[model samples]
Target: MSKKVYLVGAGPGDIELLTLKGMKLLNRADVVLYDALVNPEIFQFCKDDVIKVNVGKRKDHHLKKQEEINELIVEYAQKHETVVRLKGGTPFVFGRGYEEVRFIVKAGFEPVVVSGVSSTTSVLESFMIPSIDREFSDAYRTITGHDMKSFSEIVTQYHSRENLVIMMGIHNLKQIVFTLLEKGYPSTLPIAILSKGTCKDAQQVVSTLGEIEQKDSLFFEQMKQLTPAIIFVGQTLNATQELIAK
Candidate 1:
């Protein structure tokens, strides 16, 4: 029998949000490589004898480099009958799951993919912010806030009916707001920071571009404590507010 590698999505912080397929694979996996953001509760699904490995990466701390992770997958597959690479959110959405798949295939093994709930939509939903409310927005754009130069180049203009869902951007919140403002976004435009969303200690802060700008530097410093957050901006949030008010 040939050994195989599986790329699984662990969903957001909610262990229950894990897909049935992903859970099944974890149970049968001989070895599991999971990320840091994946809910710890999901491990309960793994077999008692399963070998678990942590391969998560943070802003400045990485347990293993991407190259090392790819190599690990191949190494495990050769030694185990079933190997699972459990990632936070969907595998394809900035999780770098595809990169692992490429390496696995090149190493002469087929990879199986299991789809999981994505944080891009679920995290916003957890805060009652509709990514696209037909009444307020027609489309939503999800982008990375890690690179300022590329971000500034890509987002040339702001659209009133387009909501923005920024990932990995909590560190650049102030700069992102100012950049949007410089690009002609309204000073009063609604914005939200969803921190540790879907987790037991999840928190949310609702403010505006102008309000944030008016706050002291200490404000941003405090915001930094809420790492691994999502930045949501658009009029759709206003609609949600009105709905709650009524």
Candidate 2:
């Protein structure tokens, strides 16, 4: 029998953040495939006979190309093994989780998705910032700091908006700050970046858009030492309504 595949969201870096359904499938996986951003504790759930493969990509480290990863998933399932691809954050949210599903279905195997707490939404909650505050922000949106740069002009276009969340943005922190400034984002707009979100060693750097360069040596310096983060921008941070107080 051709085995079925599971494309699961492992959440950020905290195993506790994983959904019960995700945990259930992970525990029974015949093969465990994961990323550099996944919580290490996930390994404890798998059996000794299970095959564990690392598809993690670190800063500056070469990544397994997307096509290669897609092929690998199909190859394993073809051999009659239950393949589980555990990803950090949601698979499709900058995790390329959707592409994996497309490949699986094309290969004639059905793919099951198990959702977990998404860091895109969870990070702002951790920092006491609201994704959308009806009283303060007109709307809340998510955009990729790096992908936005690919278009150059399009990224500059997005910077004009006030309410936004950026996932996997810290590595390009300096560039994102410069682009938004040129596009008229207020110099004093409140911005927050949470590193290693939902994890025990999480750290956050909150400052005005302009001060990111002026104070790079202090708060931003420590943030660089951490991993797996998200950036949030808008007036919502300064909203009178206390998100945490609720």
TM-score of each: 0.97, 0.87
Deviation (Å) of 144 in candidate 1? 0.3
Each model's C-alpha lDDT? 0.91, 0.77
Root-mean-square deviation of each candidate, in angstroms? 1.1, 2.9
Candidate 2: C-alpha lDDT: 0.77
TM-score of 2: 0.87
128, model 1: CA deviation in Å?
Answer: 1.3
**137 Cα displacement, candidate 1 (Å):** 0.4
Best by lDDT: 1
Candidate 1 displacement at residue 240 in angstroms: 1.7
lDDT by residue for model 1 (82-152), tens: 89999999899988988888898899998888989999999998888889898999999999998989789
Question: How many residue pairs clash in each candidate at the backbone level?
Answer: 0, 1
| lDDT value, residue 41 of candidate 2 | 86
| lDDT string, candidate 2, 9-95, tens digits | 898777878888888887788887788888888778777788888888777773687788899888888774678999987777877
Which window of 10 residues has the lowest lDDT sum in candidate 1?
1-10
